[model samples]
Target: MTLAVPSSAVAVPSLRVLPLRPGALLLELVGLEETLSLYDAFQQSPVAGVLEIVPAARTLMIAYDPLSLDQAELLQAVAARLGKKRSVGVTETVDIPVHYDGEDIADVAELLGCSTSEVVRRHTEAEYTVAFTGFAPGFAYLSAPGAELAVPRRKSPRTVVPAGSVGLAGEFSGVYPKASPGGWQLIGRTPLAMFDLARDPATLLRPGLRVRFHDIARSSMHAVEKTAVVAKPRAGVPSDIGNGIEILSSGLPVLMQDLGRAHMAAQGVSLSGALDHGNFKLANRIVGNRPGTPALEIAPAGFSFKAIGRGVVAFTGAPAATSVTSANGDVASVDFNTPIALDDGDVVALQSPLSGTRSYLAMRGGFVVEPVLGSVATDTLAQIGAVALGAGTQLAVNSENVKKPVLPGEQPAFAMPKADEIVTLDIYLGPRTDWFTNEAVESFLSQSWRVTPQSSRVGIRLSGEPLERLDRNELPSEATLRGALQVPASGQPVLFLSDHPLTGGYPVIANVAAHHLDLAGQIPVGAHIRFNALNAFTHIDFVASDPQ
Candidate 1:
């Protein structure tokens, strides 16, 4: 069926284009319908240099290669595609059997001024359209026209929302793909596995699809549970290991990371990779491994491993004390950013880094871990890709990517910031800078925000003077980038890292400069960060060209 432009929408809705970074732009539309229409148009006619397009509630984030396309040309290309009549392909209709027995059903009923049964009736009766997928893999936001079931989110979000949970927030309803932290008001649950890597499509729901909820008894829910398919583990290392590493101890689970799954934002997958990209690359280069070769991303807590056969290895990133012990009991200290030769039965151990949060260990041939969705990156937030490394995990090595000679005297791009130091990062104001008050914006740039212990690969949580905001309205979820300084209602800003959710609802006052993203990722907990704005906030105005 053709997706008709809503009667309320003008022929040419002005687009508010804002710079997200050096190579990305966020285009704000009037509403979801207009956003979807523009997305469809882009799909029909691809734009040059636009690597990926992540569509959200009312905006589209375009990530491009700056060398291939300039901002002005990209803006003109987007303007030319605007206001075009496009057809949406026919999508499948999926029926989910839901048991209307959530913990918040009664509270939702009271808020809507309706009985619990009425709440279930209205929800089951409405046919919803999947507007977009985000927050997590396979988690789709469903929208129904003229639906009066709108409700506000919970006052305080739950620490863990169970998988298969059906929830509603604002004007949309969705099912939780997996158990994770959430703030939505849940009304029910479904037995269907919303996301299963074993399945061909992986995700049960996607944008433009039709969804219907069927009320079912709790006992009958088991019948549909079989549809939930669990992913099988990849092929294990051969018993007769010729060359590999045996993890003797992993204090904090180590993750296999490469450059991450790119061009996958449309499916709600984050660009998760090594937090410190420069260090990750340096480690790989030192060991003579090809770029993007899978390597071990170690936390500051430290880990130890044993070599099964001869190979070359290198450690980079954090300034950690490392040493290798041979079977003869001879111990030799290792230096950061230097190649180390590993012999059979050699035990290598790394102590907690004196500075920074993560380190990288790269083997000459790269670890033989299987890739998920075309990458070996493990997204902690999305809970996908390679599994975390633990004690007793044996990783095989292959010489498929050993292309260059090991470089022994390589140096890191920058020094890791110590916990007591105050690191200054360059930022460009934008997409939602106006959401905060002038004082808040000024304070954000001038204040020294302390990085709290609540930091992770997902983001670096900062605590400082609460940034005052002028707009208290709930911002619809939009595409987020690494190093986005997102301010929530509490006035605290979270600097998103590699594993940040693809879409976020908080307002992003600024984004760290591209050159400084790796540095931002290495900031230690208890450290202080002072932001320096490269340019003041400015809006981009573009007039739509004739569709004809």
Candidate 2:
């Protein structure tokens, strides 16, 4: 299966699969450098269900959907062809203009021991190849910026870094694309929208694309908010059964979501959408939203909506102490345990919940949201959706509404998080679980790990013993996802959540199961935890996912 790289055509590794239980092992060619980068895989063998790929300086880390093909069947297919890796591609050049006027520009220049202009010179001089995309929507991690601009990350990360801000640290350089908390040294800012939800592709930069910075005039910077409304939704019933409630008094933090945005991982876009996929589905089933249909996923203080249409919406996740009022002024409290119907402008509002952190609002008919990248899932990470939920975001109603689920008010049967055991965690042996000492490993499985204050949609930093690694001191970046409990060389074990970076320099000791995924969603800060043996939970075979 070892074929020489053909200059005209990108090399493709023969499809070699590996078995690993509900998942498959994918052995494909990856480019490492300009002459041997693995960026060619995404361009040539563009197959469906490609989850995420993290291309570093010398290797490409891949994580695929396991439910489609079991791990056992996949390993056997890939074993023979796992020989000398061939080059996937060279690189494509793309010049980017920068302002070199970030708040940390001078500080970064001082660290590099040169004039601020020299910092910009060395940066803008040599071309930077995109390594990978993750952390946020369209956040491209460019390859090494040569040695002159090499430096460590800031000791204390800033609380907020503005969008389009250019940064450099160690071997990587990237544009912020969006405002967020980060530790990279800022060097400049860009005028272009690195990540745009309204854009056809969303993210323009991809791994292997060569990039350079060009300074632009400050006055040229302006907002790129082209609101393209796809009016008149396709003819179909919005959902099943009863009349749906209309949004009456929405208090910020309301969003329409589905499974999420995928395929754009290389562009650094996040798979943003519902916090709890299970509840999102359950609520939809109650009101009868088809898979991939748009449902409202709201926060603790949920918004109030009035029902002008006939349909029921179920609040499935974290018990939002919700109350709904009839048009006749009959106010009644509705619990998350059941589904309720609203008849024409009936107002519904979710007061703060005592136990749960988030809530789901599923209409019998899915929201009439415009689809982007084959989904209406709003990616807060990449910022894709009909629009960000705000005081003025409006949703259109469909004329030929769809049928609701089997039952509108009928409560669906399901599994929920245990009210007790604040310190218990389900586990599965990980790819690098053997790297740690038996004691360190034992400590990891037995000790109570506390949720640190530094927790968010991105990741939850835990306060626990340093799980010492006896083998190599560092690990090359690889595919990280939800419930990925990764241990960096620093000894702290971080539980990566929904918005965790696609690739990270850490060792994942275990991955939480899909059934238990909800438990990790709103793990209150300061809560304690300990790991349970992987065998403690039964393996519910996951079926292959179908595109909606």
Candidate 3:
């Protein structure tokens, strides 16, 4: 009934990997024989933007952020050094302790047709090396799930696999690093924290680092118990920074965000922030602030804030009805579009969105919160920023006696994108477009695609003709970027969003441009969409117009 295969036994086809764009994509030869060689290659002449060299069972996965360079350019640099020889660093390895007890542990034993102890023996037989860092922040897929023990992920996924879980799926064995929904066949758990926000390097270890996990007594689970504590460090930030905003009433899912953490992809940190960036910045502008300044990305049923004095504020993208009811119940419909003045005790709240799917509410003198790794972006998937702005969390208020901006700029007005009945998204043909049949690509380009209900900040699921893969490519998990078009085994093509994982095993067909982000953001569940392809010259021409 199951289609899992043993790693060692799987017939090899000589690793038929090909260069997609070679300019931005990187291919690393991993597996114990030569992967570790890249260590010296990196040390002798380190390449800029060469994020990290990960080592795993005879291979390595190289990771990078394409934002630093276009996909085509990044891959060329990698191909240029295809045959270079290097040495694995003779560095000391860290010993991590793990408890072998997971729901799927027994299932894995049966698949291997061996005793559970034998499974553990094979797993710990050799000192495993981290091939590359990916999946999520702090999640490292190590190379040691013994060929026999290697198995595919569960047919159905677990919604919340806890942090520290040790799992085996395919030839890969990894620790969850953080609590998340996963389908990896879990075999055990580790006490060692794979990802610690308070800890330096954020991700304790990276690719190529030699790691040997020791099995500890189950009783030690409590001895090495993990405690999650999020607190502001006692460092000297500006004394004027107040304890953030006081939430009178949150209209909907309102949370704080920032530009996000970059350069951590090799260590598995995802860029998590407001889903609709256009609206995010527009909200910042409404508050008399530069775009990209941290702002409250409010959704429909916008949140209400009562500031102590008049503060700069702005709103934009996904235009929604907004109102500020004074302490005396004087309602300001704000037809004039400026961030209405708010003195002490003034209360403001937004009505349900009239057109767009989301709204942004930004305040001038950006909310001063404890910056983590020089960023306030919350890795919602990793549970990393000031406790995800729960009901009672106070926003940090910058108290430098800020002077309010002169009469707010003429309220920049915009309407919601055209959706509901039919949606049109312009796209570039693709990175892995060749993996699919030409007919499938045609179907993707011309057919009507509907946004599925399972969409989230991570990715948008679509209901359409399954874009079938022409050939089964042994995809080496590579770094995935925002707007990546991925057609998984499920046949549906998913458009990854802001919170997507740093790398994935899927074949990304194409990437959505930044300018079209706002348009894609407003496509709600059940929305029907049509895809259109554009050239580089045409892309420039399309953005020539302000509206998408």
lDDT tens digits, residues 296-384, model 2?
77765657766756556678776766787787888898877466776766777777655545677776666776677766765554445
The candidate, 1 or 2, that scores higher on TM-score is 1
Clashes of each: 0, 56, 32
Q: lDDT per residue, candidate 1, 398-464, as tens digits?
A: 8655779999899999999999999999999997999888999989989999999988999999999
In model 3, the runs with Cα more than 4 Å from the true position are 1-44, 48-76, 102-110, 144-149, 155-160, 223-245, 335-337, 390-393, 399-415, 418-421, 472-476, 535-548
Q: What does candidate 3's lDDT look like per residue over 137-170, in tens digits?
A: 7788777534466677898999988888888877
Flag the better candidate by TM-score, 2 or 3: 3
Worst 10 residues of 3 by lDDT: 537-546
Estimate candidate 1's alpha-carbon lDDT, on a 0 to 1 scale: 0.86
TM-score of each: 0.93, 0.75, 0.81
Q: Which of the numbered candidates is closest to the native, going by highest lDDT?
A: 1
Q: What lDDT does each candidate get?
A: 0.86, 0.62, 0.64
* TM-score of structure candidate 2: 0.75
Model 1: how far residue 362 lies from native, Å: 0.7
